[model samples]
Target: MPSLYSAPVYWNEQQYLLSFYDPFTFRLTISLYIAGISLIPSACSAPGCISNYYPDDRVHIFRVPENPPELKQAWIRALHCDNIDRLKVVNVCIKHFREEDVEYIHKVPNGDGTFTSVPRYKLKLKGGAIPCLLPGCPSYYSSTSTSKRARLSYEPKEKEMLNQTIQLLSKI
Candidate 1:
């Protein structure tokens, strides 16, 4: 029988290992060998699963550019809106940091009151920007504890807001 195991794998052109199991009477193959294969997967967003993205599941970090005004605002809005998840909305806390005129930062404060440090991911937001950095998103919906039981839900405008934001990022 053939099985697959997801282990932390690393490789070079000469030798490589993959997710397939040990072979008692069979062989294995890897998709790529031209380039060194990092032990990690490119990403794990669920192929077409599109539950959006979970904050904690942020196994990898991404950076966004700030040269263009439209894209900058859009990326921040998307992160804030919790549009990463299709199941439910969890508004994010966005903080746009700047050097008076350098750039912006749309931050989702973690338990330690610190923002993620993804290079170039520091973003800027316009005054009108709203955030979706809710307590639970991209995964768990609905409140669990008494402290946060949001009677409110994802609003209508959020759809358009999140779309416009990502579009800006995709372009440049």
Candidate 2:
């Protein structure tokens, strides 16, 4: 017995069927599927930012907050993104935030009214934090300084006051 479907016949039939569709569109669709390109968008939302979400990358992506209108506006302005009245599903990467704004430890409360500071494996934004270190943007967008300032000591003032008090007591 002979096979009903032959290879030449099958290929000819496929080519004939494909001729009805636009070649560019069909080839593009097939190539995209074969290339395994993701349909989901996973890039940082900041303007000019090229960071993308990857499992192995140390960079962390954070969702833009929708609540607290002030914070949302601040993030939008700092990022230099416009016309984003609704920031749903928008993500900002860790590169846009200052070192102090990102929290790396979690304070777990103990039953005995004490707290233990446990290091966190994932990064989190501190409360009232804003994204101010936008790279590839105007320098004014990152107006805040990154350098930590040295704290002035009050020990000299305290020592002078103590000496004055001691002298007063001795005279009395």
Candidate 3:
């Protein structure tokens, strides 16, 4: 009978060395790198918004609130995105909200009876805040009025009453 072992193995062709290398560590490292990059949350979640997160910029990004299903749904509707999963993790930039909706100061109650207004370093959305100003979206989507509508004409009796009031005021 012939000996059982006889053939010469080619290391390069067979990748004998690579077999010893653990791919799990390499794959884990790559996965970790990608996760780290995604942790920054640099982009806005609002549809058609071009705003990005910058440390030095005045533009502030607010996380989408998960609680209050109605509020969250309103935000989703305003953003024009139906992806609830994506909205759960994404943020909306300040540009999407009205100026009044962005709370620059917070009223903190002191130990005494007085309430102090503390200026916030980080911008926050007021309660029930919803994005209304979407400049990047179509005119129909934005809450901003594109054109001024003409005032309704007063009725004859109303105009006569107004004239009488004006005349009475002029006499006084």
Best by lDDT: 2
Model 3 regions lying over 4 Å from their true place = 1-41, 53-58, 83-88, 144-172
lDDT of residue 129 for candidate 3: 75
How would you encode candidate 1's per-residue C-alpha lDDT over 5-71 as one tens digit per residue? 5443556546555545535524443333334644432332222221213222333322343445454
Error of 2 at 8 (Å): 29
Q: Give me the displacement of residue 143 in model 1, in angstroms.
A: 25
Q: Please, what are the lDDT tens digits per residue for candidate 2 over residues 38-147? A: 33335688877767533234367788877766566667776777765564568888888878888988999999999999998877997657777777788877757533
- Using all chains and alpha carbons, the TM-scores for the candidates as numbered come to 0.20, 0.54, 0.54
Which parts of model 2 are misplaced by more than 4 Å? Answer: 1-41, 53-58, 85-88, 145-172
Worst 10 residues of 1 by lDDT: 143-152
Instruction: Arrange candidates, best TM-score first.
Output: 2, 3, 1
lDDT of predicted model 2: 0.62
